[model samples]
Target: MIPAPFDYARAGSVEEAISLLGSDPDAKVLAGGHSLLPAMRLRIARPSMLVDIGRIADLSYVREDGDRIAIGALTRHHDVANAEVLQQLCPIVAHAAGQIGDPQVRHMGTIGGSVAHGDPAGDLPSVLLALDAGFVAQGPTGTRTVAATGFFTSLFETALAPDEVLTEIRVPKATAGWSFMKFQRRAQDWAVVGVSAVRANGGVHVGLTNMGLTPLRAVGVEEAVGGGADPASAAARADEGTAPPDDAFGSAEYRRQLVKVLVRRALEEALP
Candidate 1:
């Protein structure tokens, strides 16, 4: 399927990309194009213009910033998975990145693009949510930070304004006690259900994927853990606040049950 005809403009920098997006109210930013291109081909998205920001080299790095690790928005999934700094400080992120799609997709997909797409089935967003990461967005006004908890608002919708471009992702240094579990019927397929659990800040945090309109923190599970509940007891609450989707992959009820099992396994591994 061919995408509807649209104007294209390559941005040399983030500022140029923001300006291009501002030039047209219906303009969409293009990074790796993994998500947007498919939506366009299906005619689900028909932006009048595409502001290509794929060539912005400055926004493709991973580095340490004091007690946090800052990842440039354009950093590829492959790089994020392999970056030594992330491997040492935030291994769950690196592990989750490695589990996304396959090698080709990892090579082409940008962390920023995946996060900005706001897909509920995306593996990284759930990990970021459990870790309580922060996203930095830049627009005409200036830069502002959005917490992962509030960043995702709905299915394929985010708190980012139309003119805002996500520039960086910041995660706290979580050295150990973390696990990411994804359940899929086939290799490189989207997760039917996923769980990310990390022990940080004197407590355990849990995030769920494909269990709601947006990636969601398993608040009930987290609260249970905080109250000194065992892994099985904490995981039993996995379906308390979720609204999993019913589709070809699995039924919502199946996912609700699966999440409980995965959460228990993840908690056991993370809290061991």
Candidate 2:
């Protein structure tokens, strides 16, 4: 079905986009149109205005900032996959991006849009949570930083205000041990369960995907790992805090079981 008619405007800059959004409460920012457009066409999302920001080319690059890497909001999945810096410093993101969707979706979906959308099943969110990235939002007042740990409040919900636009993501530099494991019934389907891990200094962090209302870190497992538990023993705590949902695809119990198995596999790969 065709999407409902909507007004369109291409913002020359992020400030322009923010102004546009500020002008209309129901206005939506169109980054790459990969997620928003599909939702619109299916009537799942009905914004009165489409503020196209894809042409705001200035916000579409990757750079190093001190010990962290700053990725512009409009950076496409393919760009991140091809980024040598991310591959060297945060390969887990690249690996997860490579596994996001088929080539077409990856070719157009913006990283900022994906993270801002706050889909618990999306690979990027869980990876960012595991990496403890920071999201930067710009608005009429000024810019503010939000931690990935609390950015996502629930499925399809975020801490962003209506007048604000996410402009960039910051990932701390770390060439540490990490792993990303996902289980999907089909190649392009959302993960039944996914896990991301990163080892730092002396401990490991593990984040669960599609397991709860939001991307969740398996902190219990991390605590165990920190306390010198064997990988096998630590992974046993993967579902200690998660409450997976039951659906047509699989039961909640099945997802919890998958979390245990996937987390175990990811921990083994992340262990030094």
How badly does each model clash, as a count of residue pairs? Answer: 0, 0
As a TM-score, model 2 comes out at: 0.97
Once superposed on the true structure, which residue ranges of model 1 sit more than 4 Å away at CA? none
Clashing pairs in 2: none
CA lDDT of each prediction against the hidden true structure: 0.95, 0.90
Worst 10 residues of 1 by lDDT: 198-207
TM-score of each: 0.99, 0.97
Worst 10 residues of 2 by lDDT: 171-180
lDDT of 1 by residue, 23-127 (tens): 999999999999999999999999999999999999999999999999999999999999999999899999899999999899999999989999999999999
Candidate 1 has what TM-score?
0.99
RMSD of 1: 0.6
Candidate number of the best TM-score? 1
